[model samples]
Target: MKKLTTLRTKVFAAVMLTIATVAATAQTNGSGRLVKQDRDLPGFTEIEAGSAFSIKVSQGDDIKVTVETDDNYLDKIETVVKGDRLHIASMGMKNPSAMRVYIRMPELKTLDISGAARIETDGGITGTTLEIIASGASKVKLDLNVELLNSKVSGASKAEFNGNASVHRSEISGAANLNALNLKTLTTNARVSGAGKASIFARDEITADLSGAGALSYYDNGQLNKISKPGTLTFTPQNPGSGPSEEISASVEATDAGDSTIVKIGDIKVSVREGNPTKITIGGSELEVDDNGNVNFKRKKQTRFDGHWGGFELGVNGYVNKDRQFDMPEGYEFLDLRMEKSVNVKLNFYEQNFNLISNKFGLTTGLGFEWNNYRFDNNVVLLKDGNDLINDNFLYARNYNKSKLVVNYLNLPLLLEYQTNRFSKKNSFHIGAGLQTGLRIGSHTKLVYQDDGRKKKDKDPGDYHINPFKYDLMVRVGWGKLNLHANYSLNTLFKNNRGPELYPFTIGIALVSW
Candidate 1:
């Protein structure tokens, strides 16, 4: 019996020794390393990253991926390129010790993030749409230039946007927080049963629908547009000199009558009867009453522009001939070009300084850069001909597929603007007309074609007979950031008879106003 027990003990010691040796070898072979990958994926439209990892993204012409992780989990990190989208995800990591990924790609159309991850970026993100869904204890921080943003948080997650954005729409139901800075338009629908909060700073209008016990705070330069909440909602407008201001004041007085409470503030009144609900009325509109007995006060909508006179404006335009004139240089004719497809895109960075003559009248002047893209209808190439630019039809034998002209200018604009209700508490109406002069800084033409299933491009830079100086009549009319703009150039696109005798004009919607 003693010998058999000793034999079992020896067998157990051998098994344990083998296991320790294998584990040590595995650890040595699976140690972490720094990995870098780069990809040139043009025409990729979107980005989707998920899993338990920290990701940092930037903007570039191509996609660059860098990872630092243990070799044991190196095989678990995967990057998949499917169709027009690139996805990076981490798998097989139940509880990862350390992992970091950095991605750099071109401007995307959409960015989607999910899982228990920390995603961060300092600018360099420009898209039309952004979506984030966090189900774990995740966090996201970004400075984005997006027209629309949509986010949803279901766990103890947090999301923050610290740059200028046009619109933001969000929904939160967990112990999450969504904070935005320099946000223009915000619309939130939150049902927070936990300790959640949503806050926005330096915004224009906030439309919110709140329930549960969460809190929503909005700090705007203007008044709140609308609020429908069953809980607490607070809005504090910036002071006069800090931003756009509306003169608003209110005094509340409470009276007790027959076991009831009656409060009066300005022209608004509220009655809270015992064993009944609270009632409120402002002018002729009755405020919606909630079961929580919470009272909300909102000013009438005001006509104010957030970040006015000192921000950036990005927009695209449709360039078309105002009057049909089929006159071109001899031996050159316009090709089959779709009028709707001929597009011009512009980006302006300016600072507006205002000189107020009265409450309703003002003069505004600003300096900015105007980057213009004049895409041709078809593959028409431009050639220099003695201080003139004319279409070269002989270059079509190479079967050029795409061609466009790009121009950049330093511009200065002066305008006289009129605003109704500028001193009133109600919304304002605005109209501005001005003259703008531009100095040509750069001009070029590009042609693109396909060669052996691969795309090739050529750029030609010159005066191209383009005018060295240009001026235009510009007008803007709208209430807020959303305004209609028109600019008619008084000069032709090229020198006199240097090219087609076509006057250039642009009609488009301005996302920001002066």
Candidate 2:
């Protein structure tokens, strides 16, 4: 009996020895000295593109993608196609530069995935909708239709979802350029670096609960629904006045960023949700008439816009948020392309510095002609305007300036419009800051002076003598039909101190042909 017990002990010792040997061999890396795949586990046994181990999954079955490529280089991956109900993303990787995937479920409606993996797709689930959720600091390209999509990141993450995007607890570093977006959902705790540019191609909604810092410039695609008040549902960038005594839980740390918020909708609704502390960022319009669908973006931010001097069509136009706003930022005036409500038009916010050096319309000098009809129907200048002089002068009739002239001019402008199409659908933007060249064919000017401070004079200053050969500077924006343009002639129109400068900036409609 002692001998049999001794035999069993030897057998157990032998098995233990074999297991230890196997463990040592498995920990070894790839190619020792040469570059090869990291063969860590059975599932990670092979690391070659096009070589996949897939399990046939039905509606109820779980669909998972597990990758373990530690420290090894994964270059130029084609794609991983997952046709299952549930998708899992578990990857042990370092620098995954370029990797794409196309996923779809033949049975399920929505796919719920968890884990860390960087994937770039056309922005679709089943290659049709843009309902793809990304975890970790992953990059994704979405151009398809997505009903409801959101990406959450726990740590530092960077992902680019070009189409409509909704993020939760993620750090979208740089390289997240949303070209023509319907809406951008920046709730939760997220940080954006630079002033991102978003051209709302349609009437969409923007919910910004920002607590960090970044710049955001929005180009409303359609008729713009401007908001008069600040958002209540959305949080401004957080202010960590002083260091917290204890580590307080926050979705985002404002210390790591510069913040901004931009919301584009038809009018606005700034109301507190019932029985909820969170303020809801909702558009004035409904997403659907029958049922609640995904957020919808209609084109209504811009409308019947034509260059007053150039007669160019109005489209999506604004600064990249990189320039300085001496007077005002770009997109100050919302063009109601939707043309739904009573529209109000004005000059767009512009940085004239760039236009000064540009040869397209800035700096350049040329000659042109235009016929303008200044209609003072909608009191846009009186509606909360930042320019104090503009509000007072718009109300002051040029004929009241005690001059022999009235407010009227046939702008024969010959100004070189040096502009550029930096990045967008339009070719180039006409620099509205160029020194203009023009010949004034019509008449009318109001001359006001402090000499008559005691008694204000109201008389036609120049009804007969028109400002001829009115050559100065001119700058215009927009293309085709909609435009917000202005021109300031370098040479003064009046010969004496009685008349004002050729600074007649008319915010009206000018339809440009070609």
Q: For every model in order, what is the number of clashing pairs? A: 2, 79
User: Per-residue CA lDDT of candidate 1, range 1-514, in tens?
Assistant: 3463355345434543443343344433335454544434444666677676788888887767777677577778777778877777877664455667777777666556666678888455877787766654578888777777777765556787765456676776545767763444434333443335676644444555576545566654445332335554434345233322233446654445557666776567887776666778787556645578565554444344222232234333323232523233344444223334344443343344454655567776655567666656656777877756557856565677777777788777777777766544125667889888889999988889888899999998877878898888888666555555567788877778666555666555543232
lDDT of each: 0.61, 0.31
* Candidate that would win on TM-score: 1
Would you give me the overall lDDT of model 2?
0.31
C-alpha lDDT of candidate 1 relative to the true structure = 0.61
Residue-level lDDT of model 2, residues 33-95, one tens digit each, is 322232122121111122121212122222333233322433322223333222333244223
Best by lDDT: 1
